[model samples]
Target: MAGPLTSLKVLDFSTLLPGPYATMMLADMGAEVLRVEAPDRVDLTKVMPPFDGKISTAFSYLTRSKRTLALNLKQAEAVDKVKELVRDYDIVVEQFRPGVMDRLGIGYETLKAINPRLIYCAITGYGQTGPYRDRAGHDINYLSIAGVSSHCGRADSGPPPLGIQVADVAGGSHHAVMGILAAVIERQQTGAGQFVDISMTDAAFALNAMAGAASLAGGQEQQPESALLNGGSFYDYYQTRDQRWLSIGSLEPQFSARLCDTLGLSELKSLALSQKPEDQQRLKTALKDKVAEKTLVEWQEIFADQDACVEPVLTITEAAEHPQLKARGMVIEVDRGDGVMQRQIGNPIIFGVKT
Candidate 1:
């Protein structure tokens, strides 16, 4: 039942979200991960709210399956210690601004000199060789810079701030994991490791592939909530009679036709892909009025056996307890020692071995 990454060892010097999440995934896959936290600058999540008997739930979930080592890197002895450890560790994941690791004398060049097979991944807000490299930014700033924020939310209300850190987790953590794994495979063939420079901004920009493709193909920059996928068409969330939300994603021709048939609005099917703004708005209003005639649960039952892609929107709590998610084992209980059991979201990867 050993995981695929059981043979690897990782040294993690990242704090907060991105790098920690990448190493956490490695640890979940049975890699030996040593998380090094500085005494002066502890990961802020450790002190964050919602603590369980002095353990932050955020930190507990993120740092699971990893060992911790506290060290003050301001001292030369700590730098030398890391250098010694780097010789044995297979990969190193760090989240520091550009030049910070170099200033500490533990940059990629210094570590690669000691261990040529070391896979060094550096995750930053903007990359090591950009004008904004040294600029400090969080997930929101990165998303804004990548043009992702400009296309979110309704046109009338402008772009609403996202509740989740999409740029940090998707852009940084996912990309870092991908880059490190690819480097590991490449090293086996070439017998040499390489530096992975990951920028949150760059990763977020790459996520706009569909929008970027349209722009490159002579389309204008899409406005917020004005694109088909961004809520322009009839494929959107509608409020039910009970004020609860139902999501309709009948994008395909067949699905749209089925939706029209379900609602007894065959006349509206021809207006599904209407290019005229007025027609689109009229269709949206019709769909909205139709949806408002039923409660969310009623619509859920109505679409239970259909393929129109209509679904009731669930709250965060409801989502965790969803029957489909429960069947898939997306929610799991983890022991944090001392008989402390915490509920956590399970890893999405479905390897043959147990997680």
Candidate 2:
């Protein structure tokens, strides 16, 4: 079956997580993606562990459904070959330091001259033009700069989040993909392509929209785990008797009351009163005692029939093997050219066509 993006072609000159992940998403949707890898630069995913001994499981997941071209752009022949490829490709995605592409003579300006209809997306830590554009940074630094890290962990701890790669995946990869798709749509109308400069820091800033609004309205910069969504007893994670955790999302008073009723804590239902400072603390204490009374399985069964929005906190492995995930095909096994197969998170979109 033909995929939604079967007609599109992408030349991906990106290494590591963000760019590769974005291109991989497009490739999963049947976009003809040509990943340009350097012959000398070892694929970092291959260097890291959790491999299948012969091939990197991480690399296999990200590079699937795409053709790999081991090209060293420093070579004169490679440059000419890339130029020729640029003429036919619909989009070119490069995630390099600010000046690296220009130094290699494959910058957006040069590529756009060759193919004015090309959608060129450049992803970087900062951006192509900024005071700190040349500064090197990773996901942590970008999140810190965007104030995303400040709202991450527990109120008493200064530690950062470990689960979400907000800057790389959410900020960089998703932002670049959105920009490229928008550019593609705009190109159809204007018959001309444009440069999409995606700054990881700027993309991360998008996540701080709510916090920024709160700050603008004279609210203090709340502690990480003390915010309404983060700390409120009715809205956060709670540990049960079995040591497993369950998440409570009773943000509304009615839902919180329903949750309290389900847990047989009618007296604690009053804890779900207005979100005032004192009331929030009372709710936290009440929820702590109430949730501790049951195992995670018990709580799951208790809230199963209710719309109190409660769910067990699943580990990564458990989440991957979840029934809903299995039914939706969210976890798929892909061949990595070796004898072994690699498990990967599947594309979330359900397209009418397939490739």
Candidate 3:
């Protein structure tokens, strides 16, 4: 099928996750993405664990639906070749530390001059400008600096970080895609291309809009595991008898009451009367005890008829085969050569066009 971005051409100069994942999304939508990698640089995804023999599972998963070209940017001839390629591309995405591109002589200033209509996006840890712009940082450091890590984990703990790389993927990758798309739309009208500077730390801070709002209103202090949506019994995960997990999100009183009814806890139905801190604590403790009475499957069956907004947690493997996922085509099998058909998460966007 002809994809929405079939006419778009992208030149990607990024290693690792953020930039590659962003371009992967575009490639899945039919954009022609060419990834530029260093010839001798090791694919970190292959070096990391959870491998399948010599195959880099991480690379295999993230790099699907795109083409790759290894080049040494330091070489003058390679730089000229890249410039020629960029002249014919619609978008250029690079994820290097600030000034790295300038030093390589392929920065936005140089590229935009070559291709006036080229949309250039730069993704970095701190951003193109700031006091910490040149400072090195990772996902954890970005989250910490953005005040996001402060709201994670239990009150007694030292604010444990989230398992996923929120700043890198959400802030960096997804944000870059959004910026590029917006720039593309604007370019269509004005016939002028511009630069997109995306900061992982700044993006992390942007994700905490709700928490920032709460702090601004003085509704509550942003404490670890203390926020309304962060910890409270009404909106958290619980363990069942079989050690399986279930997540509850009945923040509304009506939904909480429905959950209580589903659990046959008439005595504690009053617990859903208010969302006060003490009330939430009591409700959470009561629900934890009640949920522990049965296996996750039992609760799933019990709440099948209620609007309690509860769902059993599924592992990555189970999630891939979930009925809803299958129905929505959330996973797809792709042939990756070597007589292997690998399964990867499919594109989430559903275009009107059929393939």
TM-score for each prediction?
Answer: 0.96, 0.95, 0.95
Candidate 3 — worst ten consecutive residues by lDDT sum? 46-55
Each model's C-alpha lDDT? 0.90, 0.86, 0.87
Tens-digit lDDT track for model 2 on 1-355? 1488898999999988999999998988889999999999987976776777667777888888889999999988988899999999999999888878888888888998999999999999998898989999989999999887777677677756566688899999999999999998999899999999999999998878777788768677756766777663457888999998988888788888888888777787776776577877777778888889989888888888899888999988999988888888898887777656778889998966543
Q: Write the per-residue lDDT of candidate 1 for residues 1-355, one digit (tens) a residue.
A: 1578999999999999999899988888889999999988868999998888888888998998899998898899999999999999999999998888889999999999999999999999999896898899999999999998888888899877887888899999999999999999999999999999999999999998888787768677888767788887887899999999999899888999999999988999888867777777888999999999999999988899999888889987799999988878888888865588988888787786543
**47: Cα error in model 2, Å:** 1.7
Clash counts for all predictions: 0, 1, 0
- Candidate 1 global TM-score: 0.96
Candidate 3 residues 155-195, lDDT tens each? 88766767688999999999999999999999999998999
- Ordering by TM-score: 1, 3, 2
